[model samples]
Target: MRSFYNSETGAVSIYLIIILVPIFFLQAVLIDFARVKAAEREADTAARAAVRSVLSAFDTELQKYGLFGLTGEPESSESLFSMIYKENLSGSSSGGFYKLLDTKPEEGHASLTSLYTLANHTVFKEQILEHMKYTAPIEFVLEITDKLQKPGAVKTLANGSAYAKDAEKIEKLLVKREELLDRAWMETVKLKEELNGRHHTYRARITELNRLSELIGLNTADGVRSQIKTLEEQIRSLSDSISSLNGSLAAAAAAGPEAAAAIQGMMDNMRSLQDQLTELQRRLSDLKTLLDNIVKYTGLLAATKLEIVSDDEKVQNLQKSVQELLGEAKKANDELNTELKRVSSAAGNELKVFEAFKSLKILSEDDFRTYQTGIASSAAMFSGFRSGIGSINLFTNANAQKIHAANDAYQAQMDEIYQKQLVIETERNKRNETIRKEKEKQRSKIQAALDRARQAMGDCGTDQTAGSVSAFYETLEGKDGLYGKYMTLNESPSNAGGSPVYDLEGKPDTEIQHAMSLLERLGQTGESIRNELFVNEYALSLFNYRTYGREVDGSGQPKPLHAMSEPSGHKLPGQEVEYLLYGFNSCAKNRSSAYGEMFAFRFAVRMVEELMDPKNELLQAGSPLLVLLVSAAEAAVKALADMDSLTDGKAVPISSKLTNPLFTFTYKDYLRIFLLLHSSDTNLLARLQSLIELNTERTLDHAVTYIQGSAESSVSLWFLPGVMKLMNGTGISSCEVRENRCRFISRADLAY
Candidate 1:
């Protein structure tokens, strides 16, 4: 055998045994390494699956609270791993490699020994030891012990070591990722705080707007009241002046011929003044009409102004409130930004951690390549988060600009309204000044006419004309005057006594002179009567007197009275028939013929009655004529009184009604038709009110529908479904896969 062993063939056989046997053993060791690698891949795959499930659950919870994707940070790999461990390994059936170790094992013999003891020996211990010598100082013992325990123990142990290293690297990266997630959560909280503050400010602004609306209506009401009061005072002053004038005119008629002439001249002057006063009054009435129109327009403007001003104030208040709220919101945004920066920093650190894992020599190139995919995915997710924050800021800026534009438009409209109001005020002042000047001029002319009439009456002897004047004056004083006498002459004496006349023209000469003196005194009483007549006539003309019962001739001129006729037969006892007849005829034939006829009839009838004997038929005949004149005068006074009462009744109620802008329009219509023969604008106020009511109702309905719909619609509805789809499809790939080896193993094992 030695010779054979020593031979070249024998030596070749020994060499072949040594080389082939070792080669076969090496192949077995390699197979074991492959099994170990597969186990590690399986563990990593399981861990990753578990971790991903937990992350998905967390994201769902965040979305439920409207906080999903608020922060720009990717899910941490360490957090993912920890969540998987807690969920899948913390309970029953928890006796895996993870359960065997009380804590993560350090790189030492104790960790190797523990794993080796648990694995036992089922593989070629000597070969495992040889392979292990190249890896760790204690790897020889660990590999041999692990191979002896079970048939698959050596492979499982080898694979578990690789998976454990992969998991450790993933865990380190996950730790940094967890820091980023924490920062993102803080940022989301800050942004939410800002939004809440802004909402509060908006609410306060709405309340202020409501208050401003009420103030506008109140101010308009006050302005209208002041104008109505000024009109009432002017009307009252005119009425009092007219009353005084009537008293003076009665006394003047009792004076003699010279006094009557003086009174006639004064009356003419008074008539002229009345014409001027009437013109002024007409102008005033026109001013009142214009004011009425202004009031109507102002009231309408006030209503709209109230609404607009209130809305504007509210918007401004809301802006201020919102600004304050935005300040809080900005703080929150700033905090969010800070948190984002922190998250970015943490995420970057995590990326560094992932990079550190990538640099590990223990991982195969293929495993490292899978790890790179996960790190890239995480980085991409952080970038997407930053993009989302930018979008929110853009939307906020756009809303602020829109609010500012609305405010500018409202201001421009207000300026235009103010300019129009100034023009109206200027016109009103000029009109008032002209009316005041005309009134002063009319007062001066009337006073001079009254003074001349009083002096002329003093020239006539009081006693000489007393009897005729007193008798005539007595008949005039009776209620029914001449009409009562005419009725008395037709009736029996008993009936005549009860009629409006009782024995006309039977007074003494002294009494007649006293009556004439009284009439003459009216001319000297001053221009108050003339001024009143002027004002009343002017007012009538201004408001269109012809429309209110003034008789218009064929020529379209106002003819207040038509014909005047004189009484021709009698004269006073001491007076010439020629003088009396001529004086009466001349007065009757005057331009103001009706007024002249009235005075001449009274004077002639008085003279004829005084000259006749009380028992004669001619004297009795004259008595009836005197009675008729007195009755006519009484009827005239009664008609005038009735007119005064009518004026008062209509004026009081109408003035009160004018206080309300809406009611003023209605009153104006009624007055124009009843007193001026014209109608006012129709039902304008009611139409406006109806329109406002209808608009309000429609707005309320629309608001209700909008509110209800808003509640039903989800906030997420505003987010396009396409956006979610894009994020789901592309964003997931950007997230880290911390346990690639474990994931590979599980996929491999499950492969059919």
Candidate 2:
């Protein structure tokens, strides 16, 4: 058999049988493996298709707002997944080498592994950015952002009021300082005149005394007696002048302490003059006594032929005493003149202070320091003058009576002096009363101006009218829409007389605070708010809000918003954006809060625009406080008008100075700007969910943004029964040629 086994033909046939059997087995195994791999790939494709279908069943309503979420329940998504999975598997290449039989998805395997909702900021932001990528002009958005973020383009609403308050305080203080200096200067002028008059009268009295003393020294006994009569006349005249001067001093004392001190100094000089005159009179009398005694004794001695003693030496001594008194009086006159000149210089300096204080149009730190220095210098001058003159000795009424007693001729001049005193008293009382009233009036005026300034600041409310602001608001009557209504509702009655001048004291609106917080957080992270702004713009485009008169379409055509679920089902107001911002169920509360915030931001923008405008001369001239107040009022009114035009869906200038008329923005644009300033992501998202629920009549929890789906397909094994058996208990059934099968799982994860 082995050799016959060596024969050629039969051996070749046997060799063919041996080779063909193993090759056939290997080919069948490879075909089954290829079929299994192909089926797994098909399963993967089915799972992906199924998950994609689920995503495709997104909430169409949300798409209108540029958002995406899986509609319906997760359980309902299974049926949709099953249908798509089966369809894709069944459609897989049936004409291929290996047939995929009973290629059915494993039941319960078509489940979502993960599901993400719009509550996630990442998903929500992605969707918004996606929407804006197609709809919004990227360059336009960037341009608006760049413009709003320009230096000083946005400022705090309180800045204007703060500037105004500071300016007002400075102005009031300056005016008060000016009034004080002017009063002191007026007192100085009057006192200087009185001092000069007293000085001239003293000089004249001293000269008259000198002449009398000289006449006494040179004349005979009869001539000396006559000269004594003239000296007595001069003494009587000086005494009357001293009495009048005493009354004048008392009158001047009532004007002010400085005036009183100055007049007292003059009265002291007059008293000294009276003393010198009295001394001269006494000397003359003594001389006269000596002469009379000599005359009587000489008459006796002449009868007895004795030599008469000459009294010329004593007369000459008396004349010398008079000359010395004249010299002392002249010295006193010179000292008084110097004092008066110094006082005049001080008064002139005070006048300069008043002029300097009035000259300041803008209050800089340097100007403030200069004013303080000037005021301090003037006050020191007046104080010094008062203290310097106070050192003079007091002239008592008893001393004045001594002068009067020295000459009975003083009594004859008493009536004229009394008349002059009465006139002076009447005039002084009138002038003092007038000055007091004037001071009070000026103070009242300053207080009134301050009051008006404070009132203007608080009048930042929308209802306020300033200068041309009345006309401005009137022009916005119809276009401002709900802005005016809400402004009136939110208007604070008054400043309460002394409320904080700036917006610093009161608490900001809760909505505004929340919005600002969002902005701050975004700023801290250095994150661009472009996406947030886009989302807000999307919301404005899709949602409902109070408009000028009617809601406008994307094409700027007006339309009725009767699609708001038939009125009875409407849970939100017409001002839905306002409600979202404020989260108040009450329409007025929501609308007013939104309006208040909008006004605040708009007012800030307008204020910056107004302040930064080079053409605005208000800050350069007139009362700076008034200019600031008027500018604030103008900004308030302009913001109102801006709100008007925006609500009307008309383009309003971004900046009055640098705005491109063609590049202006509308209501939705402004709303987007405000949204960029919004603070809390969680709060905003929660509100968005609530809004979606209300609008779509769907539960927020059912909304899905991301979902992970796993699917399996069953494929029968025909040729690889042995390998199938090896894979058994490892999620593969024991292989029988026609009936056994294996299952393959595929995962599909998707996000918004």
* Candidate No. with top TM-score: 2
Clashes in predicted model 1? 55
Q: Rate the local accuracy (lDDT) of all candidates.
A: 0.30, 0.50
Off by over 4 Å in 1: 1-401, 424-428, 443-460, 465-486, 490-752
- Model 2 off-target regions past 4 Å? 1-22, 90-102, 106-109, 137-528, 548-570, 601-626, 633-652, 660-665, 727-739
Which residue pairs of candidate 2 clash? 3-6, 113-708, 116-705, 116-706, 518-679
Weakest 10 consecutive residues, lDDT, candidate 1? 705-714
Clash count in backbone of candidate 2: 5
lDDT of 1 at 499: 12
Per-residue accuracy of model 2 over 1-752 as CA lDDT, tens digit each: 99676768687788999999899887877766666767777777788888898889888777666777886877788888888888888544466543444466767767775566665556666776787677766666677766645533333222333333334455454445434433433443343343334334433433343334333343456766777788778878878888887778778878887696688688778879878887978877786875665455334424321110122222233323433433343344344334334433442122111122132322234533333333333333323322322331221344223322322222223233334434544664464455455445434443343333223322223422344433322322223312222223233221111111122222222222322333333224334666666666555545665552354555677755423223223344355565555544344444555555555555555544554432334333333333434444556556666666655556666666544445566655555555555544444444555565555655434568888878767777678567665655565432223357766677888777
